[model samples]
Target: MTRSRKTTQPLVKICGLNTLTVVDAAVDAGADMIGFMFYARSRRAVTPDLAQALGEEVTGVTRVAIVVDATDAEIDAITATGVIDMIQVHGKEDPARVAELKARTGLPVMKALRVATKEDIREAEAFFGAADHLLFDAKAPKDMKGALPGGNGLTFDWTLLDGLKIDMPWMLSGGLTADNVAEAIRLTGAPGVDTSSGVEDKPGVKSPERIRAFLAAVKQTHLETAT
Candidate 1:
């Protein structure tokens, strides 16, 4: 389900990286950022020690720690590892909390907004100045089984973000893959793109081939668009 080779080369982020092998695959695939999940409820959850080790192996790629409404203690434990470059809040954190987490961890914050409607996009305004970056993701249906915060692999209407202006840097995520990512970028003009299950063989298992293909697809977009 991929598109013709196009190349916008939007800032690519590979999320839900757990093991060192997958980490290497993402890094080798030219990911701009690598995300490690810390939410205990998630199948992709990794311990702080593991994240630290994996983060150490990466040189150029930014390492991000993903949490869902985590307590100060939980966040402290993860940041204490010193491997994470950014903290991604995937929970219902208010702007004050976002600011507090940024100050406490001394790392830039990316707040995720689960969009089900246009109002959800509007909600992002609250985090404008509080967070360093914004991530727009699909909001899981209330009846969906075992739904986690951000990686449900559901796609919202890209047209919702078309011509929408916001202050902070942002990334387009949720159900993005090599197949449709080019169109997604074209529709939204996103500065960056993120993928979790889209590159995985299963919920937590990352396929190296898929990772390489996804990156190649993203890079192709930049090439096609530049010409």
Candidate 2:
């Protein structure tokens, strides 16, 4: 639903914000989007009221909700608060579920596709027209114990997506930080980027300084990559 892929500004989204300081840093640092974790299973989860409070601090950054395998009631309850601008489904929600949620909320939906191999990208085809955006994250290992779905800070082979193309717009995430986001962006040609643990000092704790550093890295990345 956004502009065509031919334009590239490299939008950056800073996720897992649970504090005002980090929120301010992201905004001041020029992040295009800011995400709040609402999944109870995630260590970075925040309450609806708290999300509203945090959202108030961001005057311009797009507010986002990162949700997991939640029910309609849960999603609606959060949407009712009227603070979230986008809903990021980081679970096993299929294309039909994506359509249902979009119809009910009248809000844009971002479908997350966890990638570990070439075939994984095809899994996202179903969501092309169904979702407003796509987020590519590293797939969690099936046998690895204690994997808590998305936001595990897993990193896949970035090279796997080199020169890749897709119908729907997408963002790249997973183990991305200020240190390597530029190289990752160059390799994958991802038009947008999302960061979680990469900007946090600890699980559920975001650092303002880290946020600034991260934004600076992306600005530099954009310059270096541009001819």
Candidate 3:
């Protein structure tokens, strides 16, 4: 489980890592979780062979496999490698599918809830038992060009999470950066946070320095909140 916002640093998940160098940087800099993209449409997508190698190098942190509306065959291929520690469904998967994925993979599942309003937030309650964790992310506008399932780098109003009453571990995501993550955490009271484009030098290209900076910012927030 992730630490509560009032107790210690939020669990930082650096998403879309396509290389081992950035993975090393994030883990070494104290990231609690690291994400690998499996959705074929994503620029950061990696083959099962490569993911296995990278997952092998992962140590002392959760190794998450991020997928978007993946097929059972595709999921089977990913889990077959026996490297992924968790599954993050970031598409239009329903609660049943979420539960199925958990049973099929035998790994904890985190269902992504895209939020643009209160109704979106309310939808998360349905997945309470289906998912091990819930992730609240910004919903991309329909007019946005070339938008994939996630990693759009957009942020919703943080106050929308205020007074949320879900009864499971959850994470805040979307448009989170080293600059604004502390404020986002303060507003949402999330126990964990996720970042993709915010720390990237470009799409699918992670910057080592930015990874370190983002983790440092999260640590600073924990220190301030603890005091």
lDDT of each: 0.89, 0.85, 0.89
Model 1 pairs in collision: 2-179, 6-220, 6-221, 7-220, 7-221, 7-222, 7-223, 7-224, 8-221, 8-222
Give the worst 10-residue stretch by lDDT in candidate 3: 1-10
Scored against the true structure, residue 189 in model 2 reaches a CA lDDT of 87
Question: Local error of candidate 2 at 92, Å?
Answer: 0.4
Task: Kindly list the per-residue Cα lDDT of model 2 for residues 106-201, writing each as its tens digit.
Answer: 999999989999888778778878999999999999998778767777889997786577877799999898898988888888889999999888
Angstrom error of the Cα, residue 8, model 3: value is 6.8
lDDT at position 104, candidate 3:
88
State, as a TM-score between 0 and 1, how close model 2 is to the true structure. Answer: 0.93
- The sequence of per-residue lDDT tens digits that candidate 1 reaches over residues 126-163 is 88789999999999999999999988889999889966
Listed in order, each prediction's TM-score against the native is: 0.95, 0.93, 0.95
lDDT of 3 by residue, 1-227 (tens): 12211223689899999888988888888888889999887899999999888888865688899998999999999999888999999999999999899888889999999989999999998998999999999999999998877898999988888898878999999999999999998888889999999999888899999999999999999889889
Residue pairs with backbone overlap in model 3: none
Where is the poorest 10-residue window by lDDT in model 1? 1-10
Query: What is the alpha-carbon lDDT for the whole of candidate 3?
Result: 0.89
